[model samples]
Target: MSSSFERYQKRRLISSYFSVVLSIALVLFLLGLLGLLVLNAKKVSDHFKEQVVLTIYLKDTAKEVEVKQMEKSLAMADYVKSIEYVSKEQAAESMKAENGEDFMEFLGFNPLLNSIDVHIKADYVTEEQLKLIADETTSKSFVDEVRYDNDLVTLMNNNVKKISFWILVISGLFTVIAVLLINSSIRLSVYSKRFTIKTMQMVGATKKFIRRPFVWKSVRLGIIGAVVALIGMAVVLYYIDKTFPELEFLKNQILIASLFLGVFAMGIVITWISTFIATQRFLNLKTDQLYY
Candidate 1:
C-alpha cells in the first residue's frame, strides 16, 4: 500500500508539472504572436504610405533634356522611392484603354500633359513633407502643376497614427499580462512543494541550496515552454505566408530572429524570477504556515 501511494503521488506531481508547463507555453505563444504584430506594424504602415503617389505635370515648353535633368535630380532625392515619366501619348493611351474611347482623337490633339509620377519613400509621406515636396516641385520653371489626392494623404496619416498608438497600448498590456500569468503558474507549482521546502530547511539545508533545484527545474520547464511557443509561431507564420505573402512579415529575417530571441529570453527571465520569488516565499514562511 505504501509503495502504491508513493507511485500515485509521483504521477500526480508529474501531471501537475506538465499542466504548469502547458499553461506557460500557451501564454508565451500569445505574447510571441503579439511580438510579430508589433514588429510588422511599421512595414504595414509604410506599404500604405508608399501607395500615395504624387504626379508632377510638366509645361508644354519643357524640353526633353530638361525633363531628363529633373528626373535625375528627383531620383537623387531621399524622399523619392521611384519616378516614372509618362509621355502625353502614353497618358492618352492609358485613359483611352480605361474609358474604351479615344478622347484625344475627339479633341483633335493631345490635351494630356507630360507628367512624372513620384512614389515618395514611406518616411517622407507625412502631410508637412508632402506639402513641402509639392511646393518645391511646383516652383520648378518647367513644371506646370503638381497633383495628388490631398484628402487621401490626410486620412492615411491620421489612420496610421491611431493604429500605431493602439498597438503600443496593446503591447504594453500584453507584457504585463504575460508576466502575471507566468508568475501565477510558477507560484502554483511551487506551492505544491511548500512542505518539502520546510522539511529541507528543518533538516539544516541552506536556503540557497534548497532553492537551487527548484529554480533550475522551473527554468528548464520555462525553456521547454518557450520552445513549444516558438513552434506554434512557426506554424502560424507558415500558414500566413502561404495565404498573405504581401504582408511581407516573413521577408524581415532580421526582425523575426530578434523576436524569437526576445521570446526565448523573456521565458527564461520571467520563469527564473518567478521561481526564485515563489521559492523564497515558502522558505521564509513559518512551519505552521505550511498547513495554510
Candidate 2:
C-alpha cells in the first residue's frame, strides 16, 4: 500500500512538472508572436510610405526647356527620393496597357499629358511636408498642377499611427498578463514541494542554498520553453511567407533574429523573477500552512 502511494505521488509530481513546462512554453509563444507582429508592422508601414508618389503634370503649352528646368529643381528638393519622367508617348503606352490597346483608339490623338512621378523619402511623407512640396512644385512656370491622393495619404498616416499606438498598448498588456500567468504557474509548481522545503528549513538550510536549485531549474525550463516557442513562431512565419510571397520584405532575417533573442531574454527574466518570488512566499509559510 505504501509503495503504491509513493508511486502515485511520484507520478503526480512528474505530471505537474510537465504541466508547468507546457504553460511556460505557451506564454513564451505568445510573447514571440507579439514581437513578430510589432517587427512586421513597421516594415508594412514603410512599404506603403514608399508607394506614395507625387505626380507633377506639365502645362500643355510649356516649353521642353522649362519642363527640364522644373525637373531639375524637383530633383534638388530635400524630400525627393527619385523622379521618373513619363513623356507623352510613355503615358499613352501606360494607358493602353491599363485600358487595352483598342481603348485608346476612341480618343483620336493621345490626350495623355507628360508628367513626372516623384517618390518622396519616407521621413518626409507627412501631409504638411507633402503640402509644402505641392506648393513649391505648382509655383514652377512649367508645372500645370501637382496632384496626389491626399485622402488616401491621410488615411494611411492615421492608420499607421493608430496601429502603432495600439500595438504598444497591447504589448504592455500582454506582458503584464504573461507575468501573472507565469507567477501563478510557478507558484503552483513550488506549492507541491512545500513539504520538502519545510524539511530543509528545519534542517537549518540557508534560504539561498534552498532556492538555488529551484532557480536554476526554472531558468533551464524557461530556456527550453523559449526555444520551443521560437521554433513554432518560425514555422508559422515560414508558412505565411510561402503563402504570400509579396510579404517577402517582412522576412528580414536580422530583424527576426533580434526578435528571437528578445523573446528568449524576456522568458528567462520572467521565469527567474516568478520562481524567486514564489519560492520566497513558500519559504515563509508556517508548518501548519504547508499541509494546505
Q: How many Å off is the CA of 66 in candidate 2?
A: 4.3
lDDT by residue for model 1 (1-292), tens:
9999999999999998898789879988999998898888888899889989999999999999999999999999999999999999999989999999998667799998999999999999988899999999999899999998889989998998999999999999999998999999999999999999999999999999999999999999999999999999999988988987867788879889899999999889999999999999999999988888
What lDDT score belongs to each candidate, Candidate 1 first? 0.92, 0.85
Clashing pairs in 1: none
List residue ranges in candidate 2 displaced over 4 A: 1-11, 36-43, 60-73, 233-258
Q: What's the lDDT for candidate 2?
A: 0.85
TM-score of each: 0.82, 0.82
Candidate 1 TM-score to native: 0.82
| lDDT winner | 1
Give per-residue CA lDDT, model 2, range 1-292, as digits (tens).
9999999999997887787778888998997788788878876787678789999998789898887887797789888888999998898887778977755578688777889999998788888999998998788777888898889888999999999999999999998998898878888888877888889999999989899888888888888878888888888888888886756834578888888898889778988998899889888999998777
